[model samples]
Target: MTSSGTHTVDAVVVGAGHNGLVAANLLADAGWEVVVLEATGAPGGAVRSAEVTAPGYLSDLYSSFYPLGYASPVLRGLDLARYGLSWRHAPDVLAHLMPDGQAAVINRDPEVTAASLEAFAPGDGDRWLHAYADWQQVAEPMMTAITTPFPPVRGGLSLLRRLRTAGALRLARRLVVPVRKLGDELFDGAGGPTLLAGCALHTDLAPEEAGSGVYGWLLAMLGQQIGWPVPVGGAQQITDALVARLTARGGRISYHARVDRVLTARGRAMGARTVDGSLWRARRAVLADVPAPALYLDLVGAAVLPPRLVEDLAHFRWDGSTLKVDWALSAPVPWTNRAVATAGTVHLGADLDGLTGYAAALARSELPRDPFLLVGQMTTADPEHSPPGTESLWAYTHLPFRRDWRADEIAEHVTRMEQVLEDAAPGFRQLVVGRHVAGPADLERENPSLVGGALGGGTAAAYQQLFLRPIPGLGRADTPVDRLYLASASAHPGGGVHGAPGANAARAALARDRALTGAAYARLISTANRALYP
Candidate 1:
């Protein structure tokens, strides 16, 4: 029999994604009676691994390659390894295929990577090395500030300290400059711009967008430093590990329990009402890991939101459109270039024009004649992801976020993507044994948090980042109302499998639930930083 009671918990987490899991784990560790409510029948939201097409062949449903995953200090604190989590990297970092049979391969060894750039342009190798060296001066602290739950003052102080030691003025310009401009100014070879642009395309934004080049450089350099790695098993392994950890600590998760509305009492979130009209009360607070709009508009009534916050939410921009295709291949993708065979990730495009054209097409709400594809050859990175001699491949491309293409049109988009690959590798399509496709609508159906099918919750544009995320003045996880916090990609510092939002929300919740355990709790946070940062 289902247990029904007015059971009150110390805190309630509204979603069971990675961020929510992080917040739940931290709070549970802090001795809070935490209960996690998940919309799906499982945890991990976008970070899930499943057998969508065939049995024994697992696919990372959303997030496959994780450069940020390894860089996330928040996840490190969880000691996921003890709960059965590990990582594996690709042999070659990545490969950028050009139109004229020319390719630039980023090797794990920075020297080899620089040499490849040198082959394309004589002095570019030296320039690339210099850029990386300069990046090293601030990369550590910069990552700290960006990911940590620092307020404007603390955040600024962190940035200033990093910049002070490493040329402030130049770093300032780099932060403001559009990615396209940065690429043009830094790299002087035919390979340079395309390589930089391909990396920028990882997000839904165009390379011409301001502040986007940083992501490209950060990710590319990160791949060089630590190759793009996947979990030893599949993405689900990460989720399962988190679940294992939570259960070990006497915490529990309720899957297929979609919380329809957040229960409120006297203007503050009290608990959540499930889709079945049942309510679960929380003694302290409720943390929501769903998208900001979904949380504010759907779960909580719009009237409850502050006017300014509502206005700001109206302006939040979801990233460009995405169409995902997962393939069950009989054999590995045969590339004419051959080097890409060993590479885990491939950025497929003819040249800069081709990429820019792809973006332009999206801007006009139309699919490009030849879409630039970000393909993840999963089996190449984790061979155990599929059966022997077979490969699992997934590719996604951005389109106009609102484009409503029909089935035939989507087929054409897939055709164009295949054409781009086939141009480099003849007979590329023949290797496909089974295939599955998901457009914006399908993505939303799979995970409601991907509202409008937004992968990163919302676009990572400058206007939407930091103080302006979700809405202005709500940056520190806490909303206008006390004890009601947002712990999702929609919160500060934006998305990825990094558990910063979750950790941030937990800290805020703990601080609010004080007085009773003030001194005891104070001692714990002092050491929490060491665990998180170390």
Candidate 2:
């Protein structure tokens, strides 16, 4: 992929996902020459799109929602709108359906959302509103803390300053509390708790696991401020915008150029070598948007890693595997309730207990007879996603890794999911004109980073979180290798389309470069500041 043989750049980024693109764009903005290498023919790894079902129906292959994208300050800096990237949102964010044919809907207005919650219990509405008000105080701080360095000392100190001692402790406990328990402790009805647990499914974490409630609460609040918006055309627009920015700044991105090994000399990263014997020589650094195990075990070689880190990789637990089905229907889903059809995202689990049961099934490595589904009606968010009166939608659920999928097994899974929806919305399958099923195997074939279909980087368990993501004492984007960094979801803050990991890696690389450039520059700046100010 070297247009010029033996090419050189200030930095070489491996994997052209959103994270890698972010680092590449930022480096180029600083006037540093950068090159991005992608394994696939096109960019936007998981954040990709295709017309899988019908001719005119546009289906998002992996991700469909972008609440984090809308709320991200890092992405806000980009003029994505100028690059033909517009966002579309549903009038209502989501709904959690119940077995009793009742549903709790999340509306844009806090007052309206809270009032709706009162349908479950007389006083639940006020509690939901008040709890959300409390959540706002720490939402920014929590985002800051997780997205920053390992200890997140500065973000933590700022949060402490705002929450004080008692307030801080309470908030910490609230975030760590399991979603299933949180709802029971805080509300008297199934609506509020079901809503929170539905959010927990965004990750692989079970509703009963600690830190699961944080996602439910965090996503709900963000949905209030910003609906789960989607790119106007498709998720591909995001990749297009990032690639446009990178190329406009004189950076290069090479596709189908798979990196074979990270070239290191004298315990320092020099660059990388592709499988085709193409060597990309980096002058300043190399940043990788890959999983920890892949980076350490495959690319860098296990011989170079510390013994403890090698051991940590052994115990690394992946999130539950996923089974996704996309459909191009002749008409919108005939939700018997009629209300659930209005939301962009819909939780298809029967009730709160149904969600917890799905989680329980995962913990036991068994397929749930009643799988919890996260269904998306793209046309609900943007009519342009499909033809007039038709729908391009998808439904995703989790399966334990033990049940390795075969072609027949995948077909069975798809049928089960359709039946589940049909139970709630009769004649649902009658509307399907075309269908595409992505089992765990198909997902891995589409994106290797998904590795056995584990989404959300890795398991967001209590032990594997904070300073222990990927491995213990290795949460920072900077790796032990000099001039090398982990800029992927496997690093701190884990997965999501947020691009925080990439931003952190870019900042880390710049800081390391300044330090490596020599202490003379550092001392000169210190002395100059003193002379000018003091």
Candidate 3:
């Protein structure tokens, strides 16, 4: 272990999830001595996998599907296979079970997928090919920007270069349009809208939001290109690989260390004061991989925060809360529409109108009469995830962020969800041998950072993105304090297990060190203040 007093290194990273671990590994690789602090005994806040319900069954603590994982440049660059991480994709990407006896199955093979789509609506399948080609052109560079870090100048420029080579004018127009508009423009049919809406729902944004259309298009296309996969074991493999890489690069991890407050000396953030009364001072910088409110209100403290920052924090908006359900099934789900049985992911909604109504109800803080569901058949996706002959499944739905969900309401909702599956897959209820439910309150209990049980760290709406994320003025990882940076999903290029925020924070801290030597740390405080206020 590196001696703390004699050789204080470059950065101190809080949290050991994929993002924090990735940042720590990157800094260590760059020859900086990195130290990671985690609040929980285990790493990977949302990416954890454990045998919670049954002794042998490994359940994903939060996120399970990983189409994005394969597409991530940082993960690919790290080559996580060096650290015992491997991934497997489902034979088919998804199965959308309609209220009617019809279903759609999507696969990686364009021919097969197009065939499936063609079966639904003739030329719509060919339309998919055209859309996919356009998607491929934008995906690589767009992903690079979203996952690169705050401001994403390099990634943005790279995307611009690609667009210019392909069709700059067309791409530019697509960038500003809402996803719903894009879908309508391309495919003027129910199938296209239904498919695109499912993709857009993955983020916390509505399809009508400007920047959200890109996410919807990118995710759906990525699923087509690389089937939505899970790590052979679980989501933990991704986090473990990151931790292994960081440790291999000489980074240290301290668990059960909750940061009480960020400490500053002469207006420069020096380190953090842990809840246990121990202070761990950073020689270079402090990276906060927790949420924005936690970074600003809990750690940074109002005494240090400028007035504008306090006001900005007051107006931040969180997305709808979510309800997650995990089921242990004795028999395979019997979909009335047999095609749904073959799907790894199943989206449930009556129709486009039903989905829109669901979203509207959520916005108004009312439980929907007809809910839209995102379901994952875990055992189907990766057989090893559960005990033999038994299926494991995970499903979730968005609810009004703060609407009260009584025990009875939760039970009713779960029953309805099962009925939804039963409508498509009769006898779905009978297949369930065991069940565990995680409501919005439960999510908040698990990770306070997911305040109000909002995933994607507050809404991804146009009003809350990019320069306006978390707060209006300061969205670039740097906070209103010196050497302190927000490295969570709450920062720019928001959420979804991407390490952009942490990477951006580390880069800014490194940049500060380069600009003014030891004095650079002090400049961070002033600059952060200006950014937060301006």
Candidate 4:
């Protein structure tokens, strides 16, 4: 229901992104009166899909694949398939193409993947299988630890119980190991090492950075298990399913309602005011599905935040800016190596040394001359993405955030990116019936939470991860202010389409409002906040 001046609800959620919708659904499921406010006319933040390139060719505006979405326990528990969500996958999950034309392909069947790896090195197939077997032992508990709230009591205990069996300590060390080192330790050939290094580049992490292996190993393992699926029609279907589920549960989302400020009283978040001058008063809580800086600095106002938090925000780092190009192709990408055509997602880079150089350039605040590309074969993954006999494709690469992405700059980057694609796929440019480019500025204009096009909310570097995320405290959703939760990718378990941050926020709010423990919970959280932020 639309309201004029003052609207009251049990909870007010800022942003209608996937995380916000997830938070709203969970709150509504508990019978709380919840309302979500979104700045854009559409609901999805980065998950939207449209025919940006050409008619009848749907392209995901931002994220495309679904390995994390498929493996996420929070998203899985929602049973979104009941609300019109269906997944489709290509025959092969991913193929990483090197400049030398050698490719490492991951197949759904482990034996097939192993065989492909074996072709690169004699004993690597068995080595891959051994690693997979080890992952199998701790997969459940480890995923739980990752997707659940911080401290992860249950998941942590479960890991402890399986310590000896799962090689828990060794696995923990591997989680922090650099992808470059991890690849060398695990495989003797370029194929295996290239595959791991390429997957690690999916994030802002460089191959040599600590904790890069965690992302690389996790994503590679997920591709093996789930095949990096996509929604049947487009990425929008995932958003539609979440919205369907949310509205069905009696939650309402107000579109074009941009929250300008969080209304507070006595240091507690009580509501939020939109740019339209409408006040949404929440009697229970307010959850913000925005980047940390946006919530703490712009919306809440720096004066209202603790001086320490305001100072800490100065040190907050964003992931690299992005440059994306979408193409509506009249025919499939004619990859030089036929094997590359089989996969839904492809990683284009030279090798480990090239990846390191690319990272070095970004660190120096210069765009890489040869950028590493993460490409998606939309039509290959799901035929509905485009007209029959044609393909909907997109590729994105990271750039240093310091660069100015003007129109001319965007054009130059697009040409460079296409050149990289053309090298892997001969005549790649000839098949383009239509083309669209989105640089960092365009992305930020579309979704403010994607500051500088940093998709992961913030850097996933070890210094800013886990308990230290978005500035240290208890890594839970509770913020310095009472009755407010950070329900975005900026929170714990940093980025991905998993919706764990939102789930964690909702769960914290629910626990704080519980009948018997309500007061105690609030007091405990407040006490922790004081100590951390003081």
Measured by TM-score, the strongest candidate is 4
lDDT of 3 by residue, 186-241 (tens): 77455665677677887766666676577767777888988888888888888888
Write the residue-wise lDDT of candidate 1 on 1-534 in tens digits.
Answer: 122445578888999999999999999899888889887777888888878767767788888888787777778889999998998877787888887877888888888888878888889888888878877776666666677775645655766776674566787778767678887898888676677778888877677888888877888878877778899888888889988898888787877778888888676679888876667888888999999888888888778765656676788888876788888888888888887888888888757878777787877877788778888888888988899998888888887776455778778888887787778888778987778888877887878888756788788888888867866553678765456789999898887888888888898888877888744643554344233323
Model 4's lDDT to the true fold? 0.90
Alpha carbon deviation, residue 9, candidate 1 (Å):
0.7
Instruction: Give the better candidate number (1 or 3) by lDDT.
Output: 1
Model 4 scores worst on lDDT over the 10 consecutive residues at 401-410
> TM-scores across all candidates?
0.93, 0.95, 0.93, 0.98
Judge candidate 3 against the unseen true structure and give its global Cα lDDT, from 0 to 1: 0.77
lDDT of 4 by residue, 1-534 (tens): 445699999999999889998899999999999999999888889998999999999999999998888888999999999999999999899998888888889999999889888988999999999888877878889899998888989888898788764567787899899999999999988888889989898888999999999999999988887789999888899899999999998899998899999999998999999998999999999999999999999999999889998999999999999988899999999998999998999999668899999999999988788888999999999999999999999999999874366788778878888899888888988999999998898898899888888899999999888888888778889998889999999999888898999999999999988989989999998888889877
Q: Could you give candidate 2's per-residue lDDT for residues 1-534 as a string of tens digits?
A: 444357788999999989899888888888889999888888888889899998999999998899887777667777678777899888889988888888899988888788779999999999988887886777777777766767788779988999999998987897799988888887998899989889888888888888998888888878876778999988998989999988899999888888989999876789988888888899988999988888989999988766767877899888888999999999999998987889999998668778878888878988788878999999989888899999999999988863367787778778789988999999998999998988888887778788888777788887787778777764677676677888888888888888888888888778767756634533543354344323
After TM-score superposition, the amount by which residue 177's alpha carbon in candidate 1 deviates from its true location, in angstroms, is 1.2
Per-candidate local distance difference test:
0.80, 0.84, 0.77, 0.90
Among all windows of 10 consecutive residues in model 2, the one with the lowest summed lDDT is 525-534
Q: For candidate 3, what is the total of clashing residue pairs?
A: 1
